[model samples]
Target: MWDLDVQPLISSSKWLQLHGLKRNKLSFSQILSQIGFQHREDFVSTLGKFVASRYADGLFPQYLRAQDGRVYNLTAKKELILHFVDCLTGAIELYKQRMEWVTSESRQLFGVIQESCITIVLDFGTVCRAEFDLCRDALSMVLSQQVAQLANDIIFSTAQDLVKWQQKAVPVSEDSVESAVKWLWKLEHMPAVSHTSSTEALLEAISDETIEAVYYFAVGDVPKDMKHLLLQKVSNSPYAIHTVSFNAREEETIIFLKELSQLTSGRYGEYYYCYYDLLISLILKAIQVGTRESLQRLLSHLAHNKKIKWLNGGRELTVK
Candidate 1:
């Protein structure tokens, strides 16, 4: 129900007045500016209106059912319309708060952040990117809850997103370290003994540029070249890799853990997560405990002790 005291222009037959509407001189943008007063406000208003109209009569704003034209009447379309306008208006209002930081950022990190996610996730939960840790941290500060924990989720999620985008990345012959690291994130199965032409091709395509270490998240096996090289080449901390894939019978699991352990001079135990039964639930538990203190200790321990040269160029990305 809407207020009878406060009326909106679109509440009644105001729709009739604008049905065949064609403003003579003013451009749509200009009209939008006038209606919403600010560009951000206008943007939110437009989106909100569309969202609300779709679910105008629903008990909740997010879930809406369209009229079948048989069972349902035209209903209170104005309620839906007004709902959207208000919703959109609210989005802009809150967005303004975040923009304060967005405006301060030299890099338009917020803009670069996909808008589609802001409502679905970021509005309430934590999010992370290269340097967008600040927002997650800010959310925790604002809520006074486990903000850092949320940051971990964001980092993991963002890393996953980066992996998703790797397929489109044009690999370089030399400086393909970034792509290599990203690709490593996407791999679910380890390289089997089968024809690994695709995996080899992916590796050969990696440039000789300095790559500190890469995170290879695999469920099954790793390549022979990788497995042999990782285990035999670096022997300082052997259990490091074993810890990660404790149950990893696959060669790929052996390789990832070994390489990571060697990369961190046996400090891979910091990031290593092993599971006996369900690794999915195990990973979730790992995420919850990965705090700033834990991450710093893990990284600092790795950074201080230099056993292998691989970790020298770029430090392994810890849970932090």
Candidate 2:
């Protein structure tokens, strides 16, 4: 304590200070030396002109977020950015083509059916006797439309029981469709005596591993409790359960059936005789283009090198 080695303490403190300075200098050099890394700034500077005005502010940022989980400060190759733009262009073209087909050639039922072998589950008990004739006619129309296109089975379900026209899916033909129509008319005379839940009927339809999908043609309001039960039961099925809402009145029924289809990775259809406003809006969006002035700006941007030139004078020059 009396001779506390003062010189040694001072020497150790100076060594630590010098070492920290060297480390800080090395870090700064490393940061400055970094090169050839791609960044969002570079992307915006190089390709920002190609984006349309309406989308310029948000589209590239959103695209970057989806592609690399970054809206800015991104480290992505220029080639990767160009590839992403190409994919977006291709997808827009494909959507246009599909919408064209949907508007021109597709009916709700046939359009939603993506599988060759399917079961059509018609909930008959939900409709009253007065509306039974309408039900029969609609089913007849479906059979006629789907003739020779689908191999299908029809399961007719009432409040208490279910009936099947064929034990398994039969290949569609003129005779088969005619037989189905006849069987549907004959059902008006039969009473539902067997005890089976709607969920059980759906299970029976899905039990056939060969069946590719199930189409639930819902015509009226399903009980709220049963709706929950159906969703829970079908949510885990390996095959999809596409739902068709035919002349349904309750909004709740449409929403529940749509959710059921979404949960099972299936399609939903609204079957009506008239066109939907939604379809019209989609068609307009597919065919719409920018104004004449904006189109000219886009053309000039694309032909910048061919249309624009530099002059030897310091003043700016313009060419058309």
Candidate 3:
């Protein structure tokens, strides 16, 4: 049965009623979305409060007698806490695995691509040789990983004109990925001149009805005039246009890409070279410190680790 006394607290809470929740039926994602938390620290704080309240009310000295219809002894309370800790630890490990997968390699770049048959447009208009190479490497990783885990086509534009890897979407496999990577390397020797007709690649990609979506990977900032034109052109695309911004020098690029993606009912991802650098550094540190305590110390420096504080809020975790 529901706790009758808590009804008064729920009814009195303006914040709770404001959410329009039908007896707290919201999922974790729904709650976060409704709360619209702006900072990671704020989320951590709120989560800490939740854990603290749950323990204080249910399993501090003993489980709540009214809720369970019997007072749980000290031993029972200890067992319950341990079980809860195990479950929480399992959830954390699962979340960590997913985060590692999502942020690994070109997953960050092509993670938004969910369709089996899709088209990728590479806008290497503004990057130099080094930047172009970086873009190529990232794309190679995507082809290797095959974020969509199926067939796909590629359209890339240089200064001269647009180029296509295949006439239609090809299945993602070991041989196909190797061939695509080889084709990508061939472009390295070409002059990295600015591609003026930005919309040409997009137009070509959309022309293919077999594709389910378009991934527009842009390395540098686009011109204001072209941004407006591209936005107008892609506003009514048949497929979602997921925009990826890499090493964007201008705030306008991020804003425009986000706007474009939102307009096309697509997702957006922004990446920087520093992200890989930081990731590499973290990996190296983990390798250097193989012990559990050292690993925890290393992770403690990360902002995400602030979650550990909340997950163990007001609980003394004795390692025995």
- Give the top-scoring candidate (TM-score): 3
Candidate achieving higher lDDT, 1 or 3 = 3
lDDT (Cα atoms) of all candidates against the true structure: 0.30, 0.57, 0.61
- Residue 109, candidate 2: C-alpha displacement in angstroms: 4.4
Worst ten in a row by lDDT for model 3? 2-11
Q: Residue 135: error of model 3 in Å?
A: 1.0
* lDDT tens digits, residue span 10-106, model 1: 2123322332123221333333333332211123564564221333344422311234211122333566547546655654554454435433321
What residue pairs clash in candidate 1, if any at all?
A: 56-80, 173-207, 174-207, 190-221, 191-221, 191-222, 221-252, 222-251, 222-252, 241-257
Of candidates 3 and 1, the better by TM-score: 3
* TM-score, every prediction: 0.20, 0.50, 0.59
> After TM-score superposition, what is the CA distance of residue 74 in candidate 2 from its true location, in Å?
37
For model 2, how does the per-residue alpha-carbon lDDT over 162-184 read when each residue is reduced to its tens digit? 67788767776778778878888
RMSD to the true structure for each prediction, in A, is 23.5, 27.1, 17.7
Q: What's the ranking of the predictions by TM-score, best on top?
A: 3, 2, 1
